[model samples]
Target: MRHTPPRAVEVHKALLAHFGPVDWRPSLPPVDELVSTILSQSTTDGNRDRAFERLKARFGSWEVVRDGEVAAIEEAIRVAGLARQKAPRIKAALQFITDRRGALTLDFLRRMPVEEARAWLMQMKGVGIKTASIILLFSLGMPAFPVDTHVHRTARRLGLIPPNTNAEKAHYLLEAALPPETYLDAHLNLIRLGREICRARKPDCPRCPLRAMCVYAREQGSGGARE
Candidate 1:
């Protein structure tokens, strides 16, 4: 038998039906996506985008960012919050890529095995599993699954992952639970659900399409128990 969550496929299908077509495509180039994701840490989408635009407008290229002063980078991204920290990581990541590949582009990861590519990205100064996975999956179309805050919370509520699983562990659990082909759709739909319905403070369980399979809804006495 496949060592997968029993109802993982069912939950994925329900989310797809609820969200309609998950039209998530790789929007940014690999290097841009990498830097954008780093800026997104602990910040709202609007703030992240503003910071990214400012940084881009200021430097115009990652190579310049790599060679630029840390103070300049930090000033460019102060709106993203934690610029004092994120700026260094972003610059360090760019430098690491340049040093390792003899170029500033992340295009080489396309030819490596997905796991190897993911591991290589994580070796950068501030890149972690989520950031690396997002870069590979979103930008490079690799099979890696990214488990963000929304994905982690929703998966646990749906009983697809163990309740005690942390964000890092949830990455592997969710990747194993769903098929590689469904990774992008599943990841995007889960985030939509979490942000729109399964909110942190007020989950609209009764309206959630996956409520029938959600342990959180059942625990709240709002839905039938999962079969």
Candidate 2:
């Protein structure tokens, strides 16, 4: 292994070659992005989209979702799973933002520095580092990397970071390696590669551009099992 890890530019180029410019993000309003990110937790995107549609049908606006009855909100989002628990959390977060800032818009946080905005978002209910980073990168167009399970698995398998790196650590390590301009695209691109190519049980190494950089792929060549 090399002393200092290679730059993310090379890694990113390899990733892009394997997964040709994935642009699959939901094109919603920033607040819609926030709500959808919450709804997406512990559920599939399709199911979350269904729940979001139902919620929109029932409420008609973010203000309604923020101020509506918890029971009704939960019912609207039941398809997303754990709606009973997630609904109130979503509504409460929306309410808090609206109350504290007079608007639930992400503009306030977007104006602040990345760290400050991330901290403020984490202070809200149900907003963890992953969620906060998603809000920043996806919604606010800020430079923050949101690492999910797929990213963590792929990064470890490729020897991009240490195997035991938690989501937060992995996020910063990746961010530091790449330019801020690459943060948002890299997040989505890696996710696509993880899902389509570098899968958990059966990574399509032969078809992956990052195979050359992947420790697991090299191990396969040497007849060694993946960790």
Candidate 3:
């Protein structure tokens, strides 16, 4: 853990204010979220959605997708930009879940504590902390905050976290401070804020709600805190 900063709280509040009552995530079966998150790794959401739609349309069921040919799965998700690499892992993850729990329902993971569920998800072949946290937060509605590139960059710029704070450490640091109930909405709000205002290359500081709290903005003198 690191020293707490007032800027962090201010930025968090400003993001929540702008993104008001975040509710973008849809409840899905845990396996679906896991698969979708994997598909989304290096691709846009539109392409990932297209790939997911193809998988659903082609397979007709999760069971079919789990047992389908790797090539077929790759073809279905080709639009996601890494189908060749992602295909086997996605299939393997589905198989892993079904083998362990018989069903890929959110109930299995959602029933456990965040730490335990995170461990369970990480056991899957392609799932890492970020992916696992996503499953816990989005699928199970658990108190796991996932830090993507946007959140990581914004936190660093706002001086909410120290330089080069890895996503795993950042996750723990953030979750420890915020109430568990705020985890879901905060994650969404932060992502929206990151995309809309606190962009990586060119932050819209003048129009930003948390402009007053941004160390990078205050330090335009330091050439804008390039990473």
Candidate 4:
């Protein structure tokens, strides 16, 4: 008999059974969340937090960061890794928004349609589908799904998306496959699952909640067919 790949919703349900409830709500405003997400690229959470705090402490405001010397801004975020690259991108993004909207706040995105807002954010220097979705879903309370490295890998292992699908395309596919209400929980749990069980290097497939339904786990002989 041929095995059918699990649906995204089915995988989501399995994840919930394993990981339980997760809080994915964003406590920060859109702009703050944008900056934080930018800082998160290519860095650990601890380093990202320290870099964010340092930048905020040094600049005092987004406008100052945007207008300040690039070298100074880079110095403030040196601990985040890729500070030279990230600092310019962050400053340019803030400047882009300020130039277009005349302010640093992204409250306007909350009013725009999801796709429109996503497109608008994508126009920024370093923003992409993942970053735009993060701003939309977390900060603006939209239904967009942001696919990071973990979510991308987990989705592929579960066969929720094509094996070769890039994270950028996977974002839309996964978002479309799942109900809007399930996005937050599914996204959060998938990240946790990826971190704890379905890791990139050596996933603990035997103990994975979705192992029975996971194509990768099945191929590895770590999990059997679903009962």
**What are the C-alpha RMSDs, in order, of all predicted structures?**
2.8, 3.1, 2.6, 4.3
- Model 4: lDDT to the true structure: 0.87
Per-residue error at 192 for model 4, in Å? 0.5
Which candidate should be chosen as best, given TM-score against the real structure? 1
Error of 2 at 52 (Å): 0.7
Query: Is 1 or 4 the stronger prediction by TM-score?
Result: 1
**Native-vs-model 2 lDDT?**
0.82
Residue 107, candidate 2: Cα error in Å is: 1.1
Models ranked on lDDT: 1, 4, 2, 3
Backbone clash pairs for candidate 4 read none
Candidate 1 Cα errors over 4 Å, as ranges: 1-6, 223-227
- TM-scores of all candidate predictions against the true structure: 0.95, 0.91, 0.91, 0.93
lDDT of 1: 0.90
TM-score of 4: 0.93
Model 2: residues >4 Å from true position, as ranges? Answer: 1-5, 24-26, 222-227
RMSD of 1: 2.8
* Model 2 TM-score relative to the real fold: 0.91
For lDDT, candidate 2 versus 3, the one ahead is 2
Q: Across residues 121-212, which tens digit of lDDT does each residue of candidate 2 receive? A: 88888989999888888868788889998888888877878878998899888877777876766777888888887777767878777777
lDDT of candidate 4 over 99-179, digit per residue (tens): 999999889887888889999999997899999998888888899999999999888988889999998899978877888
Query: For residues 1-227, could you state the per-residue lDDT of candidate 3 as single tens digits?
Result: 54444555556677777767875665677778888999999889899999999989989987898889999999999999889889999888888877887875557676788899899889888889999998888877788989898888777777777777898899887776566777777777777778887788767777777777777888874344443
Q: CA lDDT, every prediction?
A: 0.90, 0.82, 0.80, 0.87
- Model 1, span 136-222: residue lDDT tens: 999999999999999988888888888999999888888888889989999999999989988877788889898787889989886
RMSD of 3: 2.6
Candidate 4, residue 208: how far the Cα is off, in Å: 0.7
